[model samples]
Target: MASTGDTVQNLPVEEAVARGGVTEIEKGARDSTDELRHYQSSDFASLRDEIHKEITSRDVLLRKLEESVTRLSEDIAPVKDYVMAEMEEEDDDASSSSSDTPEDGAPQDGDQETEEERNIRALNRCVDVMMSLTEIRENNEEKTKKVRGFYEKIYKASPLTSLMLKFLERNGGVKVIIDCDSKDISNLVRGLANLDGEKCAGTTLHKFADFFECKVYLGGEAGKYQVWEGLKWVDKYHDPEASLSQSLAQMVMYLIFKNRGFPYKCDDDQCEKLYEKIAQEALQKMTSGAYMDYLINDALSMKTPLGREVSLISVVPGMLVKHGSQGGMRTLQEQVPFLTYFFMQHVIPKMRSIIN
Candidate 1:
């Protein structure tokens, strides 16, 4: 945040914010010991001009490339037509010269068939390559346009999203929420989260927003995505027991305790043993309405953490049944054909990970 003599740069955001709002950087950090100069509007204008020139050049290049490819394709069309015509001629010649066809009226020479197939595959591959290049060029052009727009919009909208993205880029496993809509930034977050060691521990919300008690925040989501650290996701309908809102606090506490080496007022080993005992007791008590009546009402009222946990897990097996249209019970087991299919619809895996 320190400045060199006669050097200019964008004002640090903290200095701008502390000045009472996002204005008056000079007054905000006026008490600073280090010398500084405001980055002049003229300098930003010059930078803008330079960046615009670069984009213009790129657009021109892309336009030229597209035209050139079109022209090349046109020039190659005659050759392609000629090749196809020659292939047809060869096929006709083969049929005439080879042993007469039977009822099927087709030649069955294995050697001729193999040679023709090789030629066709080579020609098909060449066409496929051309098509692939065309698609790449088109997509690049579209993406370039979107990126340019994103840069413009980032400045026009809030800078909070950009700040979160940079933080998450350096430190993985965090996410954030922001009011702005920028595909470029959203895509960046997705790529980061998809990278190894970057995903959150659990919760389908996909990213972190400075959720309640997670981090400090200034403004609200303004109906935009709830971002975690830098990850973006839409909030969806979820039952309280199955939702991140209900579970994130537990995850936070667990992470805090775990990071501190599991320090607590009680024995960690006993905690595990207690959970095991509860699970055993719940299984022993499983029955119809065991999910709600026996386990939840009977076990939890025993007035202990051990009692509550065993009762909680007892509800899990009941989730496997989904109601039919006429209200008959059908199992998720028969409905989900694959592990992935089950994984998406079932909360058991997420619950298991978060609970433990």
Candidate 2:
């Protein structure tokens, strides 16, 4: 109100009044906005720090979990390996044990049978052997008995008949006598005869020769015949180198004489008697070199009648000859066929019969 300048100043005041408190209000609002922005920035910084810490903690936890997992795997791996190895070892041991076992469940291959089982097997074998032996013996005995009975019947029926005539007639006839005491005759006869007597004789000779050949030469009940004491005396006194024919003749004569009962002729007074003087001459001839030569040629050639190809030299006789060289000449004769046959047929059979 005083001048222009004062008027300008007043105008300004008036304008300010008109805007009412707009400028002050605007400034206050601006200051408050700035303060809010600053506060918001600080809050955001705190939030970011907290988030970083949380992330760092999470990372640490993850690392620890990984380490724990690694440690657990490491611990379990050895245990797993050990368990597997143990299982493998157990399997190996079981397999080995199974392989080593025997079929009988024993641990050794040489497992033996029980004693009772062995004894049972042995007993069975013994029974089998004994049964076989018994059968053989029974058959042999039956054959022997039949042969003996047939011979005894023949001998008893006609004691005085000629052997040849007896052989020709089947019924109530004389049986051929086998002088088994004559080794030379026996050997020659046995060589010629067959077991069945088929090839030994024929119709030309009459069935007598065949029958006689079988009974005397071949194996038969002739083995059961007893040599007369007279025939034995003839054998004891016969010539060493005598022919088989001569020896056989002597045997026949002895048999005839024995049957007739050698009788001495006497006078009516009975003061003087003349006895047959045949024995002394026969005894002188037996020990000569001729008899030894005959025995060597004939007796040594005899073979077993059983059809085995064995020679007398290959048999027990040969063994006896080898061992018995030191025995006396008389002892040797006793070992010959005649004595052997007598013992084997008569003495042994009687002894066996008694025992049975």
Candidate 3:
């Protein structure tokens, strides 16, 4: 070994370098790279834990969404079912009516009804109207009209002629008189009542004389007194002297009397009774089917001059019927069908326009 090593050393550096000088250095570099490529068990465990966490989070979110959807479906299901049942009943009724013509050409009774049964049916119809009232309040104008029509149909079909009489009496403490017999009041002089003329001292007086069975001027001390008396009667509607139509007339007068200007031409002094006169005028305007616009045009414009800006819907909070207030009962529009009908038709349509 000494001889061979000594001979190689002496042989010259260039001839020895040609054989395999850097093989060990190359082997050491390859071994270090192989060591670094090995993955540890702890790293694999950490990656698995992260994946599990993400899977659990996704599962929780999915479950929460499903629960929310389930709750919403549950809430709507009953309403859907009730509406379907009502539609089916109506269809059945329509089919039976068309198919069942009696032998004498008269409509046959689907079933014989007793007195108690008729009463019960009428009660059901009233309940249906009550339900539809809430429905109309919740729905939009287009849908509300359909719901209201259902209630109207029910009311028209009912045999109860004096429905408003008892309802007004119980809720509004007012009486409903079909034909009020007030004496002739047109021939009476304005001076006799000390009523304000068109050129009154404080506010110009508008002649409501023809509007009533008698002559009465609005926008004066007497008109205020009448309003007070009317409110008193209405607030205590159960009293022996409560008149629904009179109370409503007072409320309407109170709302618009301040905008005094002119009056509509009445046929005659006693042509139409007070309540009938007011209702007929309202009915005539209702033909256009927009109560608020009718009031703005027919009531406000007819009552006041063009420059006056009087709004019936928008008023001071004090104007709303509250406890000890002189205007009306707190819920005047709800109890009196006249007010209720007009208010809903106006307010609902206004709300829809605003939303759009």
TM-score for each candidate, following the candidate numbering: 0.19, 0.19, 0.20
Residue 141 of model 3, lDDT score: 56
lDDT string, candidate 3, 127-222, tens digits? 454443231212455644543343333333211111321132123322111111111112222332212223322122222322233222222111
lDDT of each: 0.33, 0.31, 0.32
Q: Supply candidate 2's per-residue lDDT for 38.
A: 92
TM-score of 1: 0.19
lDDT of 2 by residue, 148-266 (tens): 33333322221111121121221222223322223233432433343223344221111112223223221221211222343562222222112211222222322332221111112
Candidate 3 Cα errors over 4 Å, as ranges: 1-167, 175-297, 302-342, 345-356
For model 1, residues 1-356, the per-residue Cα lDDT tens digits are: 56576555546776566665555555556635233333456677889999999899767754653454334324334433444454455466554554544556664657566556644543444333322322111245554443333222321121221121122232333222221223122322333321122443332232222323342111111222333332665342222111112122222323333421111213556445434443444444443334433213333443445334422432222122112211111232222112112222222222223323
Q: How many backbone clashes does candidate 1 have?
A: 12
- Best-fitting candidate, scored by lDDT: 1
